[model samples]
Target: MTFRTLLMASTAAALLAPAAQADVNIYSYRQPELIQPMLDAFTQETGIRTNIAFLNKGLVERLQAEGDRSPADIILTTDISRLSAAVAAGVTQPVDSAVLEENIPAAFRDPGDQWFGLTTRARIVYASKDRVDPAEVTTYEDLTDPKWQGRICTRSGTHPYNLALVAAVIHHHGEEAAKTWLEGVKANLARKPQGNDRAQVKAIWAGECDISLGNTYYMGKMLEDEEQQDWANAVNVLFPEFQNGGTHVNVSGIAMTRAAPNRDDALQLMEFLASPRAQALYAEVNHEYPVSPTTEASDLVQSWGTFTPDDVNLMDLAALRGTALRLVEEVDFDG
Candidate 1:
């Protein structure tokens, strides 16, 4: 047997015993520090040894290449696109668990049970506190106005966060209208789309730009990072259009590998992760919103107040990724 096949077989046998303390292999898109606390909790609670391989890129490719030889039992990532891609690539499986079904909203999980979002993050506007009056701007379309030109800073359109934002637009407006929106956004660029969300805040702080679209958690991280706290402090977060259309929210979720050798353990981990306790920790540690229906926000996050998330179905958002990409490229967003 191939080493992967042998490894999987051994893990399968080991996990089937129920009482057997075995390792749960995870391929995580999050850095170790961000997720280790949860893993440690799991280990402490269940005595299941956790082994992780964390990487920001190429994990999907690596899993695909490893095929059945891949020892991975669980795959974790942020954003629906990667979860969707994992399903499309045949790397994940449909899992049934009452705990998961009860805890996570139907909209945040895959139609086929391929993935489950553990936490959510709003895609809110970060505006200069002293400049933009919060009430004056409430919707995404407002950014396209001529007055906002030379005032926006954002990451590249190709980033998943931007793609998901465009996808939400497509969910509301048709592809043509979505394209028009992208073009308008391109026209408003303070500079060519560059940098991560924190950098956008830095831009506003430095007077390089006055507003930008950013994931809400970046605000928390910037505030917590002593080196970057000033960037976060200088800007006020504006939750757009919760009155008409709710703010766009994205998620970080997980899935059972299609060929998982430790099916039961994988399911247990996923269920435990989706549990109110685990879900709360996932959000608290990473500055995200929990998917568990009953979970509460961390104190720092709670201070941001609450607003309705846009009702756009995340699966629908994932479906529009290709179109969003093409539209972004057509608009020469990369240039």
Candidate 2:
């Protein structure tokens, strides 16, 4: 099965089908292009037609509204907060699969098995190769130094990616320290926190700032786009670690829906996703580190270099999300 042959459903209702269809439905926050190859491979191997309904937001609310009638079999999303939100909303069910257990690391999966991480991307620094000395930015705490004032760039502080990083700071240091650090970073902003990670890289290319915080994979993405290639080339990927910990990382993960209409097929897809073959394919396509301990990152991802991942359980960071958001607002990080 190829990308064209894979059934791409426009709505969740289209996924409702008889048992003979051998299909699985997905409610995914991930873009279709990023997962197309993995879906095509799954269809070819399992003969299970996949139907995905992509949504930018409101997935948990939609699933809650649909209740048992939801046609979605699995929920695919990035970040631990969203995954935990679905579980808290009573939209996801625990999955007990030996294949998943064997493939994904304990730190990357939910304690209750409500979600399993598929890939991880580090919250790293993107430094201007021309203007910034790599030694100047070595850890997350260094971003707050007085020397970097008016020299840093970042997305909105309240964004989930930044919140997770803030949460990790709270985990390593105390809440008060994290707030001070956030304030220092805010003071260093080249402009009001604006745009996505890629935009921050573009700013570096334009000489708007000396360094920016972003996920490692955006370098790979920028390199792939002809127009963005220059933006990517302008920066060097730097993995910043916590003061006493390793690099801060977040995940893109999956979970079975509570009302999984096609439970068997969903399980098959979930298991296949955690398998080494699929993990490798996902890593190569998305330019993220595969959660499967046995799978190595793609050649392009490896070329960016390496860092020891922080050993903190991601659920702990998810737990601190509310407080993290409050800190962002308290400091007026975007202002």
Per candidate, the number of residue pairs that clash is 1, 0
Query: For residues 122-141, what per-residue lDDT tens digits would candidate 1 score against the true structure?
Result: 99999999888887678888
List pairs with backbone clashes in candidate 2: none
What's the TM-score of every candidate structure?
Answer: 0.92, 0.96
Give the true-structure RMSD of model 2.
Answer: 2.7
**Tens digit of lDDT per residue, candidate 2, span 97-211?**
9999999889989999999999999999999999999988889999999999888999999999999999999999979999999999998999999999999999999989999
The TM-score measured for candidate 2 stands at: 0.96
TM-score of 1: 0.92
Candidate No. with top TM-score = 2
Q: List clashing residue pairs in candidate 1.
A: 138-241
Instruction: List the lowest-lDDT window of 10 residues for candidate 2.
Output: 4-13
